[model samples]
Every structure is written in structure tokens, then in C-alpha cells.
Target chain A: MTEQIAWIAVDWGTSNLRAWGIGPAGAVVATAGSDQGMGKLAPQEFPAALMAVANQLALPDEPVDVVICGMAGARQGWLEAPYLEAPTDLIALGQGAVHPNMPDERLRVSILPGVCQREGGENVMRGEETQLLGLAVTAPTYAGLVCMPGTHSKWARLEGTRIAGFSTAMTGELFELLKTHSVLRHSLAGDVNGPERDGGFLAGAQDGLDEPEKLLGQLFEVRASALLSGRTPDWCAGYLSGLLIGTEIAANRNQIGTDPVPLIGSATLCALYARVLAMTGAAGRVVDSTEVVLAGLKAARASIA
Target chain B: MTEQIAWIAVDWGTSNLRAWGIGPAGAVVATAGSDQGMGKLAPQEFPAALMAVANQLALPDEPVDVVICGMAGARQGWLEAPYLEAPTDLIALGQGAVHPNMPDERLRVSILPGVCQREGGENVMRGEETQLLGLAVTAPTYAGLVCMPGTHSKWARLEGTRIAGFSTAMTGELFELLKTHSVLRHSLAGDVNGPERDGGFLAGAQDGLDEPEKLLGQLFEVRASALLSGRTPDWCAGYLSGLLIGTEIAANRNQIGTDPVPLIGSATLCALYARVLAMTGAAGRVVDSTEVVLAGLKAARASIA
Candidate 1:
């Protein structure tokens, strides 16, 4: 038998593009990605990019419904999907128009809308709708604290599939600032323990979890006093690592109310956040975001199917 | 009529060397500076840098007792003066060298000692001993928090001429890292503000101070939400201002512990920090560092005179 038509799922974002080809049974057969992220391209350019990737699987004219999420469906993405302000459903993440430039004979696509949030007066999240969907789909039991950490960290309080409340933390940028430009630079020396996750980083994160409020002033002091008074740079890095993670712990301490915190990210990042939160005497479970992203993509795909 | 010597003072800092010659009553007779900074030259080079400035004054080696301060007295300065651990004194700050190179020559130089500190477990400061002196001399009998804002901000508890305790905050570098490298950068356009103090900077600082504690999380939202929701770059700058100054407010909330907070800096930086703190119903005062540095230099000279 010849290779059959397959389902297409994608998680297009700011700096990256990821797509998957799934069989009728929902198992992924092939996948592709590129540096051509939505943030770099205009909203109209996404169709051509998606089609370029779709052509890779020799997709036949039998209309392949592209169930796209992430930043690809943002206002600046392939289609202008308006934000669905929380209390969402497939109805909330609505379907937008197909590519006006592409021929009807080549493809049929549906871009997913993102979610908006307003809690404690006003707060919002757009592209994270899918990531939240992925988390909710993968572990319906993941009801407490779910955090997706990266350059922009999103912490959500999930009560089942419905998101109760959420917040974002810019821990990644703070880490970069201290290392390169601040007085703390003298203390960092740009080199630290192996893989950045040796016992030192974990131990430091634990330190943050314990005392978040008093750590900001402490963060700069570690690197500063070290360089001035002859302290090691590695300890400085570990100290800074503690400060940023510690600040996040303080910011999220309240939202993580009641249930244990579950961290979702790549193994290394998850361990770093989890281990640090653990140090605060708060138990945490690390989950894989890739799995959640895939599960989220599958959920979006099923909706279109 | 020959130009007569009045007072001799110096801004003998780490990397910038400046000295002034005044009429007998401390009016500028001649001013000089050179690349021959304490940071650039060895202990032996301090004499040459001093001479380079003195030669510019065209003065004979009279009984002019020159007062020097800043990094020139550090372990690596013109004379290796050790830091006086806190609960410091003018004597401690006055323990610098008399220029072993010229004390016997009737030419005099008194190097000032830096202050050391360990508060909230451990954090110390040097060089600020002079700035703290500057603050006290300029705004004597003024009680409340005095913030000397810079790359590393020193928040001091100044009581008359004595520096009781102080804390350092890395607000500047943190601003750079977030604006240039963080996801938040996507939200910030390339302008720090339109120009000088007339621009949107103060507006941004005001918004930041409005929600000081929620700063870290809101930072990520500015970028991530902007990418998905289309928030402007200007707000990103404001968010950055908010994160940094907001952290400062929380870090220095003790400023309003009993009395009003006094801000010490150039008019611009002090105004910004003052406005942010003002939002919390606290009073503020801005004093010029130029005057403080000069007055600090003068006090240092008379103590050895």
C-alpha cells in the first residue's frame, strides 16, 4: 500500500517552528521545523511556510486540515485569531480563515485563537493557550501549580482543564542581566560548574525557595563582595542562580496555594526549578513540556478532525 | 598680580583623575584631570598623575596639603589603604596615606579609607564611604533614607556624619539585561526615551512604582503578551523601569519606616527614583553629587590640614 494522507499538527512560536505528521490513529509519523518562526514573519507569510513543510510529506490534494497553535495563530501569525479571554473552549480558540494567497486545490488550514487573562486587576497571556491546553490534556490530574519556564516563565493555577489563574515571570532576562552588564559580572567570570545543573545550581535554587523577599539585595552582594573580597566566581553564579529562582519562588508562593507545584519544561530546566522550589520546603514534580506540547497539538488536531 | 593658591581638592576616583586649585577661600583657580587614573597606573604612578594635574596649576611645591579620596586609597590605589569595617569614623576614612612619595617634601596628600559593611547576614561596601561622607556634609542633620543611585545603588541609613548601615541594589545592569537580551526586548523599541528628562521615561517610572511588588512577573508579560497581543515597545521600557525601581521600593521600603527618604544623585536619576517612591506617599529630597564630591574632597583636606 502507498503512503497515506496524514494529520498535520504544529506549535509555531517566536524563535522556532515545529510541525508533526500524524497517522489516522494519532501517532506521529514524520515532523519538521525551521528557524522561520511567526515572530520573524508577517501574518500573511505563514501559509507559504506551512505549505512548504506540508509538501515534505507528499500530501495529496485530499484537503489536509492544518491544526495550528502557538504563536503561529497570534495576531501577527498566519491568521489574525482574536484572543479568547479565559473560561475557554474550542469555541473560545476559534478557527480563522485559510490562506487568501494559496489555491483551494493545495491546502485547507485552520489557525487556533490564543487566550487572554485578567486577574488581580489586569494580566494577560496570548500564545500560551496551547501550552496550557497541552498541560491540561496530558495530566488532567495536574490541578495544582503548573509552570512553563523559559525566557518568559508562565505559572498557572489549573483547576482541572480550566485555568483558574496565571502569572508570568521574567527570570531568564534577570539571569542574563546580572551576568553581562551588572557589577555582578565581576563575580560571575562567565564560567561555572559543569552543565550548569551540578549540585551547586540545585542547592542554590533551594536557597531561593526558602527566602525570596530578602534575596534581591543578597543576589548582587554575593558576586560583588566575592570579586572585591576574593570570593569564587562559581559561587557567585550559584548565588545569582539562587536569587532569580528565589525571586520567582516569592512571586509564585501565593498562587501555588494548596496543592504541590508541578514544573513543566525540558529535563534540565524542570530539575532546576523543581529542585530550587524543593529547597523552599515546597514539594514539586517535574513534567515534560514536549509531551504536553504534543498532547496539546493532538487535542487541537482532534477538534479540527 | 600672581594667581594665589586657596584650597587644594581632588576627585581621586578609581579610573578618573581630577584635581582643583582654588583661591585661599575655595573658588576655582585652575582645574585639571588626566588618563593617569589610579586604575590605570601603579602606586608609583599616583605621584606622576598628581604632578600632571599640579603642573597644570603652575604652582611651586608650597605647603599645599592636597586631599585625595575615592579608589586611590584602595589596596590597589596610590596607597593601599584598608577598608574600615563599619560603625566607621572620619579617622577610619582618614587613614589613607600622606603620599609617602612627598610627605617629607612639605607637599601633603591624605588618602581616604573606604567603609566596609555586613548587613542582612552579609553585604559590604567600599568607596561609598566617601559618597556617604559627601551626603552627610551636604545634607547634615537630615534624617531618613539617603539613596546614592548608580550601577550599584547604595541605600544608607545616614545619621549626622556617621553611616549606620547600608544596602546595595544592582538596578542599572538589571535594566540593560532586560532591555537588550530578555524576551521583554521584543516589547521594547530601541529608544531609552525620546530625550533627556522631558520624555516618556518618568511616565514609565511612575507606572512601575504603581505596582512595585508585582514587577518580576509583569516583566515577562510585557514581552510575551506584546508578541501575542501587540503591546508597544515603550511600555516594555516602562515595565523595565517598573521592575528595577519597583524592586528598589520593596528593597528600601524601610525608607518610610519612620522618616522621609532623601535621594542623592544628579537631578535626573534622583528625580526618577524620587517620583517612584513618592507614589507610596513618601517625601523625597534630591542633592547634587557634584557638590557632595567636592565638599567631601574639601572635608578630607581640612581633616589632614
Candidate 2:
């Protein structure tokens, strides 16, 4: 059964490493992950970290192709996979993949290069590019705006299989920073992502959409609302999240255009973005990040094959 | 000369304590300060911290009236002064002052209450209210919008000597957080507050003012611009500062009205703000925060007297 495995697919990011064992027929045989992210590993540690998971599947002695994407290719990661400038063809991403030397003869890893925008304002994305490639593979002719939300949310405008231009928003990072490290932290002491879907979240999103420039002031109102309005901790958390997300959406509203913005990410995060996008009168279609990442890696593998 | 000290004006905030010795003739005599701020002091440590500075100005063993403002009056400070609800008469702030028991017989400290707005949304300000009082004392008939720029930048609408309504923007804090904690820290390394007045600051501010909702995305550009445009560290610092401040100003543009907004803060900081405010088509009159605080404390003293 293990002999059926043909290649491997990995999404190696800053904080975590996820891998899926793909069969010869393109079916996923097994999947695994660890906290051994690129940020945690030095050049020497990359092979062992990958082998730690590779050995679990009792991979045969034959060489196996492993398609990797994300921070693993950063300058500080296992090997530097230089950024491919934007307006890049998704099909060409495979050409940008750099092969990192591995101790195990059985594992041949190709790390995909992240994309960089050198003009306008400098911008870069590592893993999301793979996700976009995956999205491209899923719908070969799909074109419009694509948003992939996470710690560093990426918004891209795609023309067929080529990414025309893209922008990254610090919404997720800002939300986390405000939730855990700010004065509003006192008011949001409880579950920062509580089950309670308080109206404060929608209200905050609406406020951000209505007046995105006033965002910093609106954020202060979270603490103020807690102090004066006696808003619950859950509501405060929801409001802050809403405001950050709403502002991000409003900031990129023009990019969304008339097309249904395709949101690629985990269900929880995508749901939030989708809901907010709908609130802004834009349609959103959610796609699981795993599906897109796998499809993206598979596409890269096929291209290399 | 020491005995000429009629009273002590103290601005005890979260991180530091600043005091001014006032003569009976209403002139500032000598001044001193200590690192022991509200955040650093326990209830028992407050008096000693105050004494550390108070003792420097040697005097007879007689009680000296110390009018204190800022976080020293917070629930967690020397003594809780409670909030004076907004639409509050600046003159009444002194009436709401609370006295904390002191072991040093020579110090009779009166801590002023903060101002809180309960309507619309909950908002609170401790030290800024005193500055408003001081501004009022300087210009008794003054009326219009006042901007006190700091960690929690405040904007207040005043009707004569009363605070009609007010709002706080976490501009300074956000700047600090992004500079020190966020990924932008890489580009903003070295002097967080550099002497360089790169045109980048004004440019960033103008961009923020022009399109505030695009702030989160624009912030990413700081990093992008650095990576691609090779922007210097000083330029990055100024640009970030401008973007945050400009966005804050853009958000609250509706409140600026036609009058010259009074900016109360240190000369260096207020100058940056004044410049930004001017860029936004409004005139900004810089008022030294020290002068305003002292005048505010003096006004409170007279009201109590």
C-alpha cells in the first residue's frame, strides 16, 4: 500500500509545516504536520524535520518528488528561492522552484519561489502564490479577484492564469496584536474568538466600511465601549475582529470588482471574510485552503513531471 | 526661594511622573520628576514615589498642596478619582478631586478625576481633561475642537469651559506597536524616533489622508517599499509615523470644523501633528502640553480654593 505513494506535497510556512503524501494516481495517501516551521529551523535542521515525517510513511528507498511552497524558500529558510516578480504566469511557478539538497537519497524536495512586486509599493507573498496557482488549476479559465486570508492576507487580481497584481493586508496580524497586546486586551480578557456572534462585530465591520480612514479612532472605541457602554468581552473581541476585517475589505473594495471574489483559506477564517464581503455588497465564494494548496502542489508536480 | 512654592502641579502618568513647583504669584518655580509612574507603583509605593521628587524641593515641615492629574488617579493608581462624566464642566473636575492618605505630613495631594463619555460609545481620558482645563484657563472663552496627540491621541469638542464630547485615537500606541512588535520592525530597526525629516513622512501622511481605508494595505507597502524601493530606515520611520497620524486625522476630519485646532503636546511631537493637520487643510495651533497641564492644575486649585 505504501509503495503506491509517488510524490509528496508540502506547504511550509513560518510557524508550521504541513505535508500530504500523494499517490501515483494523484490521490492523497496520508497527511501530517508539525510545529517545525521555517522560522524554527536552521539550514541544517530542514532535512531532519522533513525526514521526521517522511519516515512515518516508511517511504521506499527510491527517490520521491516533494513539491514545497512558502517560507521554506525564504533567505532565512532551508534554501533561498528568489522571488519571481509579479504578473507571473501560474504555470511558470514550477520553473521558479529551487531544489534543496537533502541528506536522504529517497527525498528530492523542490521549494517554490514566492512572488514579489517591485513597483508601486513593494509587496511579497510565499505560500499564497501556491494557493492561487491551485485555484488556477481548479478552474483553468477563472478570472477576477482572489483573496486568501491569514496572518498576512493576500488579495490578487488574476487575468486567466496570470496574476496581474496583488496586495497584502496586515489585518490578521493587527487583530492579534490588538486582541492580546493592547489596552483593549483588558476588556477582551475572555475568549478572543468566542462563540457569541455579537452585533458589535457587524457594527464594527459596518463602521470600518463606512469610514475606513477613521479606523484608529474606531479601534479606541472598543475600549471606550467597554468602559462606558458596558459591552461584554465577547462583544469587544467580535467588534475588534470585525473592524480590522472590515477595513481590509473596504480598503480593497475597488479590486473586488463585479466578479465573485474567491476566498481561499480555512473554513473559520474564510467564513469571516466571506460574511464581511457580503456585507460590503460584494459576493464571496469560499474554498478550503487545503484543497487549493494540494491542487497547487499537484499542478506544480505535473508541470515538473 | 524654596518657600515661594505655593503648590505642586503633578502629571503622574502610566510610565512617568512630572511635577512643576508653582509660586504664590502663579509663576513656575522649579520642577522635578521620577520614573515611578502609575503603572510601576502599588498603592503603598505611590507616596514614596511622590516623596522622592517632592523631597528634592526642600521646605519646612508644613503641608504643601499637590494637585495631581493623570493615571495617578486611576483605579489602579495612588487613589481612584473616578471619572467625571462628559458634558462635564472643566471647572468641576477639581470639585471631584479625591485625596489620598499620605504618611509624609508635608504633602497634601489632591488627585483630579478623569473625564468619561457614556453616550454614543464609551470613551475615557484621564490626563487630557486636565490639559483641556489648562487650555481653558489660558483662553477662558475658547471654544472649538482640541487635539491632544500622545499614546492615546484625544480629540475633544468644547463648549466654553466644558467638554461637550470627545474621542480617542490609538495612533501613538499603534505606531509604537508596529515599530517595535510587528513585522515592520525589520524595516524600522535602529532609532525608532530618528532626526531625519524625510519627505517620506509627509508623503505617507498625504497618502493616508487621501485614502484612509487603504491604510492596512498601505502599511504593507511600507515593507514593500523598503524591500523594493530601498527606502532608508529614517524615511521608513517618518513614513510610518505619517501614515498612522494621517489616517487618524483623515478619520476625524469631520470634527476639525473651520477653527484652528489647538494641538497640546511636546513641541517636537505637536510640530509633526501641526504639519500634518495643515496638510489636511486645517490650521493647527501648537500649545505646549506642560503649559496646558500647569494651567489646568492651577485652574483646578483655584476652583477648589
Candidate 3:
């Protein structure tokens, strides 16, 4: 007999959506995804978008539990899911999940709420909370600083499964803007390989780590170095990347302890962050973002069950 | 008789070109400007673009001296006027001026050289050098820090008529990019006036000044503040402006001594910088940029007279 599907898990972000059908034993039985992300769909369109992915899986006769995460629960998304305040336990995430009104009787849907910090400074995260929950499930005793590198990189302090506080740095976004739109665009062309790339990266990283306060002043040097000294575009690009990442690390240096920080993100980006962290006399380990998010969804499913 | 144009002064920048016809008494006899800046013209096209403005003034039978400054001297501009290393006397700027081949015998164009600093870091200034020279000509005893706020805000250390060194911050450019392209774009809207605008600006300025190192981390707070606490777009815009200006001031705090900084730029921008400078316990006085550029051009003309 074919393995009976237990439930459905969906990670609906701004640009894309991914869904998985889990079997009774918590193993993925089927997988599907679409470009129909939260950004594209209206409140009424969300049901159809989800069904497009869900229809791929073999649905049982009865209505199956469907847990959704990310921007799908935002105020502008399918249904508004109010944020749970920070210092919230990972285990308690499922209890806060809000049920969106489902049109089809075959689907029982619940969207997980995001987390927000209000005391120190205003901050919010929709999708990352689930990943943090997954991290907790995968490693029950792990607790310290966690760095999730992306466009808006987040650095969170965790106490066991609870997120104490977190801050975001717009490093990746700024790098993209500077590379594509700013005056440094021309200076940041071409590609370099091997030791030269490493050298350039290290030099810029060192500058950023040592004197982040001088960042605004140092940015023009990229263009000047190219114009005056004819520095290659590849070196400039590498240097810019290292500078932004290094500055991000330096900004959060106060929270990073001697313990090895778990960097959760794509391998390439996490690797860059790890290298910069090592340069600052700190250790970092890569944690696959996909694995954690899935584990977090599973944990949430179990909480509701 | 019609006032014979003694010479012409042109500030050919990236986006716009402005020309003035000087009388023998050193007063402006005629003025003209166009969108045909250095960025749009080719090597051969420079003559016609210059004439567009020059033709407006009364011309004599002989070729008239046309002293040009700004990006017109850039490598990509009409003619490449090599940068004179910093600490060179401002009065000697005319000596380094290069003359591009002119098709019109009625115009003898000389583009003034910009200043470059290579000892500490790579830095080059084109048009602003003329203004600095103008400042030197107007106030011969002035020797201190000069702040010029624009798209690329410049802070230079001056000794008499010499520019000792200078650094640039892309504060204004970054602000525009963030407001138009970043996620915070939605949050930074509305028209704030009076005390509300000042309050927002001061609050953001204080944060930026107090914790410049955390700038990267603090940027997302703009979006968060709007998302969580419902900040008005006007306030957000004002805050962003304050934050950037404050951060710029903080970075250059070392160069800013007890001496009052002479801010050279548009009156509106200079006022903002002056306010931020005051907040840092430093004083700033506005100097009209146009007056200085004209004076500097006149000085260059006199040197070659």
C-alpha cells in the first residue's frame, strides 16, 4: 500500500512558495513548488495558489492538516496572523498559529505567526521564527548566538529554544545597491579567481572589521583605487563583499561569545560569513537552512497534534 | 556700448552646465546654463555645448578666455586635466590647467585641474577644487576643515590656499537609494512639518551620532519602527535624513576641530549640515558655493592673465 500522507507543510515567502507532503512517519512523501509567492497573490488568490501545489500530492479522503509559514501570514498576505512577542519559546510557536478560512473542505490550513521585538527597538521577522524552531528541534541543548545571512541578515541571541533578542543588518542589500546602482558600479566589474580574490577580500574585511565607523568614508576609495591605481574590477567586487560582511560581523561583535556561532543560510553566503567570523577570532559553523526549516515545521506539526 | 565680455566662467558638472560672462570690472555681465553637462558631450561636442552658453554673451573679434571647472576636466569629460597632488597652492591651479583643442577661434578654453590625495588613501575631487580655491581667494587666512555637502559630500582639511587632504562620503546618494529602492521605501512617506519633522530628525540623528558603528544594524529599525509603531512617512524621511547626516558628521568628527567649519554648497543643504554640526558641539557657517567658484575661476584667469 502507498504511504498515506500525514500532513502538508508550506513555506510561502515573498517571491516563491514551496510545499511538501509528509508521510505518517514524518518523511517527505511528495514535494512541489511554484512562483506564486505571497507577493503575487491577493487574499482570495492564496487558496488557489496553495491548491495548485497541494493538488500534486495524493490527498486522503479526509481533510488534511496544512501548516504554512512566512509572509503568507503577513497583514498583506492571505490572512493576517498577529506576531508573537519575542522571548517566545520555540515549542509554543504552533499554539499561536492562526487558521485561515479555507474554501475547500479537503484542506485544513494553519499559518504560523511571526515574532516581533518591541521593547529595545522595533523589529519583526515572519519566516525566520520557524527556522529557529527547527534549529531548536534538531539540537535541543544548543543555545548561543545565531547568524542568518541574507539580504537583511539577522543575528539572534537564543537561550535554549527561546529567542532573547535579535538585530538585522542590511549588509547584503547595501552591497547589491552599491554594486548595481552606485558610482562604484563601473569599478566593480570583471571576475578574479584564486589567491588574488582572497587577498582583496581579506584587505577589505580587515579594514571594515577594524574601523567600521569609517565605512562611509572608505566606500569612495573603491572608485578612487580603480581610477587612480587601476585596481581590477574582480578585486574591487571581492573587496566590497568582504567589507560589507565584515562590517555586519563587527556590528554584532558584542553579542558573539567564544562559542562557535551557527550560521544558518545558503552554503556560499554562510561560508563568507564563517571566514569573516574566523578573522575576528571567533568560530562559526554552517547549518543548512532547508533542514532546519523542515525540522521546525515538523516540530510545529507535532505541537498541534 | 554693449559690455564686451572679458572672459567666461563655466562650471560643467555631470548633470548641468552653468556659464557666466565676466565684465572688465569683475562683475557678471551675462549668465547662461543648460542641461548639456559633461556627462552628455563627446570630445568634439564640447565646443558646441560651450558655445551654447558662450554665444549668449557679447563676443569680441578676438578669441575670449573660457576657464572651465568641474567634471569637464574628468577623463571621460571634454579633456583630461590630470589631477594635481594635494597640498599644492590654490593660486597655482591655473598653471596646471589643460586646454582642449577648440574648433571655435572665438573661445580659448582652459579646464582647471582637480586635486588628488594619494598618501593616506585614494581620493580625487574635480569641481569642488575650484570652490576650495575660491574660498582660499576670498578668505586668504582661512586654514581648517571645509565641508561641502552634495550627492558625494566632501570634507577637506585646508592650510591657507592649499588642500592638505580630503575624504568623501556617499551619504546623499545612499539616502536616495534607500528611500526609492529599499524595503523602507513604503515606510518613508508623508509630509511632516514643524516640530514633528525636527523631532524625527533629531531622534535619528542622535542614534546615528551615538552609535555610528551600529549603523548597518540600525537601518532596519526604520522599517520596523514604521511596521510596529506606525511611524509616519514624513517622520521616517526626516529621520533617515538626520541619520545619514549625523553618521557622516560622526565619521569626520576627528577632522572637525573647535574651529567653525565653512560649509560650501546650496543654502538648504548647508543649513542641515550646520544643524548637525551644532549638535556635535561643532560650529558651522554657510558659504555660497557659486560665489566661491566664480572667484576661483577669476583667480585662475588672473594667474594666466
- The per-model lDDT (C-alpha) reads 0.66, 0.86, 0.88
The number of the candidate with the highest lDDT is: 3
TM-score of chain A of 3: 0.95
lDDT of 1 by residue, B67-172 (tens): 7767787666777666666665543355543454652353466776666675444555555667677777776876556787776677877777777777777676
Give the proportion of true interface contacts each model preserves, from 0 to 1: 0.42, 0.88, 0.74
Instruction: Kindly report which residue pairs in candidate 3 clash with one another.
Output: A134-A296, B189-B233
Residue-level lDDT of model 3, residues A120-226, one tens digit each, is: 77789988989998988788788888999999898888887899888889988999999888999989766644346677788789888988887887888888888
Give the candidate order by descending TM-score: 3, 2, 1
Candidate 2: the clashing residue pairs are A122-B224, A224-B122, B134-B296
* Range of the 10 consecutive residues with the lowest summed lDDT in candidate 1 chain B: B194-203
Which should have the higher DockQ, number 1 or number 3?
3
Question: Better model by lDDT, 2 or 3?
Answer: 3
Question: Each model's DockQ?
Answer: 0.43, 0.75, 0.79
Local error of candidate 3 at residue A23 (angstroms) = 1.9
Candidate 2 per-residue C-alpha lDDT over A1-305 given as tens digits, one digit per residue, 9 for 90 to 100? 45567888999989999988888788898888899999899999999999998777667668999899999999889999989998888878888888889988899889998899876567989899888988998887788899988878999988767988899999999988887788889889976556554587898889888878778888999988887777888888889888988988988887677877899877888988898999978989998788989998888766663
Report RMSD (Å) for each prediction in the order shown: 4.1, 2.4, 1.8
